[model samples]
Target: MLAIDETAAARAMIQISRVAKTYRTTDGEIPSLRPIDLSIADGEFVVVVGPSGCGKTTLLRMIAGLMPPSEGEIRVGDRIVTSPHSDVGIVFQSALLLPWRTVLANVMMPVEVKGLPREIYQPRAEALLKMAGLGGFETKHPWQLSGGMQQRVAICRALVHDPKILLMDEPFGALDAMTRERMNAELQRIQRETKKTALLITHSIPEAVFLADRIVVLSERPGAIAAIYTVDLPRPRQLDVLGMPEFVRLTTTIRAHFNAQLD
Candidate 1:
C-alpha cells in the first residue's frame, strides 16, 4: 500500500482516493494513470514531478474537476468534486490572457465567468495585480508584457476570485532559465502570502524542490506514485537553497529515480 503522511491525511484539504484514468480510443484503451492516492493538507504546497507522459497533468485536471477519473474519487474540504467548483483556481503553461483585454480585465475574467458582482471583485483584481508587481500595467495588453510578466498576470487572474486551492500545470515551462527561476521565487512568495493550497505539475527537479512542501513522483505512462518526499527544508527558501546540502540531496535523489528508470 502507498503510505500517506499521517499528519497531512488527518487534515487533508484535498483527498484523492484510488484515482485513475484510462482513455477509450478507436485503437484501444490507453491507460494514463494507475490507481493513485494522495492527501494535500490545507495551505500546503505540493509539486508533482515525472517523465513527459507520466500522467501528472491528468492527475491535476482530475483534481480541478475538469475530467472524471476512470475509478475512485476526489474530494475538497468534505465536498466531492463532480465538476469545476468555485474553490479552485488553475494556471497553465500559457498565460491564456485575452489579447483584447487589459491586464486588470484579464485578471477579472474569473469574476465574469462566475457572475460575481463587479463592484466586489474589481478591487480584488486590481489588488492581486499590484501584489504581482504589475501595479502600473493594469491598462496594458498581454502583447506588451514580457513572458514572465504575462505569467504573473495569469497567476493574478487565477487568484482574483479568491480560490482556496490553486492548480498549476507546467506554468513556467515556456520561460528562459533565469526568468523561470525568478518566477519560481515569485510563485513561492505569492503562495505564502495567499495561504492557498497548491498543486503544481513540473518536470524540473530543482524547481520542484524549491517550491514544494512535499514532492510526489510518478512513474511513466499508466503513472503510479513512485515516491513522495517531504521537503524538510526551511520555508521562505531562497535561490541559494539550491546550493544547500539538503536541497542538492533531495534533487539528486529525485533525479536518480528517472535515471534508474532508464537503466
Candidate 2:
C-alpha cells in the first residue's frame, strides 16, 4: 500500500514529487520527463506550457494515472494515484465522441462505464450539457455540431462525472483563433462556477497566461520545471482582461522564461 505523506496534504489537492518518465524501445531508453516537483491547490487552475515534445502531455498523463512515472509518486487528496479514478476527469485535443451516439449519450458514457444506474446519471449529464451551452443540442450527433460545439460537448463529458480534478491536454488547440478565445472564456466561467481543480497542458503561452492562476513553464526534451509565474490579476476576468497592461507584463515574463530555456 502507498503511504500518505502529510507534507503532500499541506495546501495541495494534487502533489507530484520527483516524478520522471522514460520509455524503453529497441534503440534505448528515452527520457521524456525529468524529475519534477509540483503542488496544485484545490480549486486552482494551473496551466503547463512548453515547446512541442517538452513532455507537457506526459506530465498530465502521469497525473491522470494514464501512465506511471518511472520514479517518485503522485498523490491526489489523501490517496496515491496508481490508476484512473472517478475523482479525476480528462479531456484531450480531439473531442473523440462516438458518431453514432447523441451528445447526451457521449456525456453519460463514463457514468455507464462505472455501472451506475442510467436514471441517476442521466439528469446530471443533462445538467452538464445545459451548463456547457448545449442544452438543446443534446440529441444531436457530433457530426451535426461545429468544431467549437463539439469541444463544448467534450468539456461537458469530462465534467459529467463530477471529477474534483480536470486534466486537459490542449483541449482547444484544434480550433481556430476566434473559437479558441471563446472557449477559453467559457472554460473560465465553468471553472469559476464549479470550482474544480484543473491542470491544462498547452503550447500557447498567451493561452496559458489568459487562463491559469499559475503558469508552469517546462524545458525541452527531458522536461524539467523552468519557472512558475503567478497571475495576480483579479478574478472573474473578462475577455478584455487579455488587453490589460498587467496581462501583457505577465505574458512577457512567461515568454522570457520560455526563451531562456531555449538558450
Candidate 3:
C-alpha cells in the first residue's frame, strides 16, 4: 500500500490522496497510474523516477492541474487542484523560449499574460536571470544562446512569476551529459536559495539521487510507488558525492529495480 504520514499530510504544500488516472479508449480503459498517496511538505524537494512509460509526466501534469485524476484529489496549500492555478510554475525538457523575444522578454511573458505591472516584476525577473547565470544575456534573443544557456533562461522564466511550487519534467534531459551535470548543480543552488517546494521527474537514477531530499520510485506502467527513499547524504551536494559510498549505494539500489524488470 502507498504510505501516508498523517502529520506530513497536515502540513503538506501538495497532497496526492489516492490519486489515479485511466484513459478510456475505443478498445478499453487504459490505466496510467495506480492509486497514489504522497505528500510534499512546504519547501521540500522531491524527485520522482520511473522506467519508460511509467507515467511520471502524467503524475506531474495531474499536480500542475493541466489534467484531472480519474480518482481521488490533489490539494496544494490546502486548496484542491481542480484547475491550473497561478501558484505553480512548470519547466519542461526543452527550453521552449520564443525565438523572437529577447531573454528578458521571454522571462517576462508570465507577467504579461497575467496583466501584472512590469515595473514591479522587472526587478524580480532580472534577479532570477542573474541567479541562473543569464544576467549578461538578458538582451540577447533565444537563438543567440547555447542550448544549456537557453535552458537557464527557461528556469528564469519559470521562477519570474514567483510561484510557490515548481514542477520540472526532465528540464535538463535535452542537454549534453557534461552540460546536464553543470545544470544539475546550478538547479540545486537555485532551489536552495529560492526555497520553493519542488517536484522533478527524471529517468536518471544519479540525477534523482543527487538532487532529491526524498526520491519516489515508480513501478513500470500502471505506475505505482515502488519505493520512497529519504536521502541521508549531506546537503549542498557536489559532484564529488558521486564517488561517496552512500551515493553509490543509493543509486545502485534504485537501479537494481529496473534491472530486475529485465530478468
Candidate 4:
C-alpha cells in the first residue's frame, strides 16, 4: 500500500481543464472530444461510459500522457502531463502479456522498463499478484490462465509499480459475460483495497455502476460530458448490490442518455 501524503490528499489527484482531442490527416481533420473539464479526487474510482467512438479511450489516453490533447491541459497532482507520466499505470482490453514470460515476470515489466532495481520490486510484484488472487500462479504462463485470470494478471501488473492513478480502457471487455461480472467484483475489491485514484472506460452500464464512485457519461462523436452520476452506494459493494433499487435507478437514468441520443 502507498503511504498517503497528507497534503497531497487534500487536492484533486487529476484535473482536466477543457481538454479535447482531434486527429489530423492529409485527408481531413477529425474531432474526437470536445473541450471538457473533470476533476478526480485522491482515491476516487471514476468510470467513463459512452457510445462507441465517443472518445472515452481518447480521454483516458490523454490523461495517461500517452498522447497529447489538442486543447487544454491535464494535471496529475501538481505536474502537467506533456509526456508519459511515471505516476500513472495503464491497462487495456487485452492482457497483452508476453507469450514466454512467466506471470510474475510480466507483472514486473514496468519496473524493469523504468530501470528500477528488480531486487526491490520483485517482492512488491509478488505481493501484488497475491493480492489479485494469482499468488500461486506466478510461475504459470499467460496462455495457461483463463481470460478473467489474465486480466487479473494485467491489473496486478498495472499496480506493481504502485502508481498513484490507474487508467483502464475496457479492461474486461473481452471476457465472457459470467467472467466479466466476476472480474467486476474482483476489480471493485482491488480498487477499494488500494485506494488508487482510478478512471476506467467501459461500455457496460452495469459494470460502470458497480465499480464507480462517480460515473462520467459522454455524448456521441466529438464527445463531451453528458452527465455525471454519484453512485451513493455504501462501500465494499458486493454483487448483490446490483439488484438494489438505486442501482437499477441509476443504470436506467444513465441508459436514458444514450437512448435519447438515438431518438
Which ten-residue region of model 1 has the weakest summed lDDT? 1-10
Candidate with better TM-score, 3 vs 4: 3
Model 4, residue 62: C-alpha shift (Å): 0.6
Instruction: Report lDDT (CA) for all predictions.
Output: 0.94, 0.90, 0.92, 0.93
Q: Which is the winner by lDDT between candidate 1 and candidate 4?
A: 1
Number of clashes in every candidate structure?
Answer: 0, 0, 0, 0
Give me the displacement of residue 176 in model 2, in angstroms: 0.4
Per-candidate RMSD vs. true structure? Answer: 2.1, 2.9, 2.0, 4.1
Model 2, global lDDT: 0.90
- Give the TM-scores of the predictions, in the order they appear: 0.96, 0.95, 0.97, 0.95
lDDT of 1: 0.94
Candidate 4, residues 1-263, lDDT tens digits: the string is: 23454344348899898999999989899999999999899999999999999999999899988899999999899999999988888999999999899999999999989999899999999988898888899999999999999999999999988999999999999999999989999998898888899999999999999999999999999999999999998978889999999999999999999999999
Candidate with more favorable, higher lDDT: 2 or 3: 3
Q: Which ten residues in a row have the lowest lDDT in candidate 4?
A: 1-10
lDDT-wise, the better of 1 and 3 is 1
Residues 105-169, model 2: lDDT tens digits: 99999988998788878999898888888889989999999999998899888888789998899
* lDDT at 28, model 2: 100
Please write out the lDDT profile of model 1 over residues 150-249, one tens digit for every residue.
Answer: 9999999889899999999999999999999999999999999999999999999999999999999999888999999999889899999999999999
